[model samples]
Target: MKLVLEGIGHAFLGRAVFEKLDFSLAPGEVVALLGPSGCGKTTLLQIAAGLIDPLRGRIRRSYRRHAVVFQESRLLPWVTTRDNISYGLRVTGGKSTSHRQIAERRAREVGLHPNDLDKYPVELSGGMRQRAAVARALAVDPDVIFFDEPFTAVDVGLKRVLQDLVIAAAAREHFSALFVTHDLSEAVRVADRLVVLSEGGTGFVTNRRIDGRPGDRSDRAIFDMMEAWSRDPAFSELFDGERKGLP
Candidate 1:
């Protein structure tokens, strides 16, 4: 399946975060939407998902079988980890001993502990919650997965596991995803192609294809783009903002 975006633009409160944007994803391709905070990365994702409409352009894609991992986990506070994943499968009418078994199996696959399955969100660490969120997204078996900085709060060790899990999932189900993140290293780790938002409130793509698996974060190609973009005024200003941190 091909996910297409043409002339896509968005704004909020009369302020434009992005304008005249165009991008797309093919089946099993993982693309990153990289931008500074408040630059409409998330807003653009909403436009892509049809959760919100763009202010000035059209979003064309086949929906009806898509899932999203928001910046926030948005898990049910009252539900256990196991139940959370199971419930999502239920929402998608995906039910079976096989589905629950697969969900639990995937929970383990994502590094969630067996003991943690029955625990509530309140008991889990920030990274754990994010893992549960990923698990829920997995339960849906979506053709398209929209990830909105899904691993922001995680630690490096945990982050690598989460990142690998996503790549693994994409490979397993052959699902295409639009992953939004500020970390260039992370984008390089998982993205088949990377799209950068410009200071002029526009964006364009960088790569047309990545290796079979994600490239190593330390790969020479990855460093070149990061080094060049580090001095980018728009990116620099974004770094100067409160969200400043190394990628």
Candidate 2:
């Protein structure tokens, strides 16, 4: 299965952010979408999620189910982390092998302890909150998972952990991903393919067939890719070593 983006285009509030944005994700492929701020990265992700309508172009996919992890945890403030993780499963009536008690099992796979199941969002750190969000999305057993900067506020160590978790899941579950992030380092560590978002969110291939090196995120090749893209007149001014938001 693959998600094909043919000439995908969009504008925000009368301002064009991108045009003719084309890309695709084959089954089990984790593709990272990287671009500078104001390039419409988030807008592209949202369009993929059906949260926003594209002003033009066509998106074709045959996936039966999908899920997303927004940059912010976006959890229900009132629920415990465990409840939050299992909430989507309950809502969708999801069932795996044992159908009856899969929610608890799913949370355990993502490293959430049974005890912390009762802790609410107010009690967890930013990283832990995002972890719960990840577990929730995975529990849905989606064919496509959209991760919109899942590691932003997370510390480096935890970012590695989360990246590994995502990679392992893709390997085991054969799920495809459209991961959006501004961190070039992250794109190298987790993606099988990379699409750089140029000015106004237009995407152009930067790196493909990455075959992620979970440990060598800082490799020279990764930096070289960033340097080459940054030197290109189209994207040179985008990064500028500046931080960008999920939007």
Candidate 3:
């Protein structure tokens, strides 16, 4: 396994978020974590990424490098897109001259135009900012990446494009990922396996392997799988409010 969480539990301000959660990720695998709002999916991803220490658990990570793409772009507004993309390299101590070269290469890989590289985050579109965010995470050449609902704010078309970018990048780079999202269709499109958290963040509801490879499934197939899972008893909590017409 590339990462493992054993008996993990965490709380904030004396309010428990989760308890005794055991999860693991294999090399080059993408796992989508699903749950209702406030179920601690992001918290768990943060724990796995070592952003926060669990109050009770043991986390074992075999990979040497990792990066996270947050729900918001979270880029530094003061910096140009080129500098933002290469920020990881700077943190890791890369030479100044090489930062620009590496940042441009990563920007190109994520479909950012060269003209956009010199612009600050305030000057870019939401999609362009997200592209730069993804590029920033990739610039470090991480072995593992943590995604916290990274596409939820984008339009549907742009969301799919970003999803494809992630799938292609993961395939080409062989990086494992833990993607946190509430969207089932997005999960089917991106993950090799889907793991759901139980209501109230008590524990896992299910951890099931997806039928096909991330990029191999057709749109119809992905939709069908999502439709079927929406009716599954194990996934009821996730879709119950929608079915009941509750906000």
Q: lDDT per residue, candidate 3, 39-144, as tens digits? A: 8988899999988988999999999999999999999999999999999897788688899999999999999999999999999999999999999999999999
User: What TM-score does each of the candidates earn?
Assistant: 0.84, 0.86, 0.96
| Candidate 1 structure quality by residue, lDDT tens digits, 1-247 | 3677788777667777777887777777888887666667887788888889777776667645788998778889998888887776775564567666866987887789989998999999998888888888877778899999998877788888889889788877888899999787788789887776654475653334544467344567767866776676635654564356445
For residue 142, what is the lDDT in candidate 3? 96
Model-by-model lDDT, in order? 0.77, 0.78, 0.93
Model 2 residue 25 lDDT score: 82
lDDT score of residue 145 within candidate 2: 95
Clashes of 2: 2
Worst 10 residues of 1 by lDDT: 204-213
Evaluated against the true structure, the overall lDDT of model 3 is: 0.93
| Candidate 3 residue runs with Cα over 4 Å from true position | 241-247
Q: Local error of candidate 3 at 139, Å?
A: 0.2
CA deviation > 4 Å runs, candidate 1: 94-99, 205-212, 215-225, 228-247
Off by over 4 Å in 2: 94-100, 205-207, 211-235, 241-247
lDDT of 2 at 119: 88
**TM-score of model 1 relative to the true fold?**
0.84
Of models 1 and 3, which has the larger TM-score?
A: 3
Candidate 3 all-Cα RMSD: 1.4
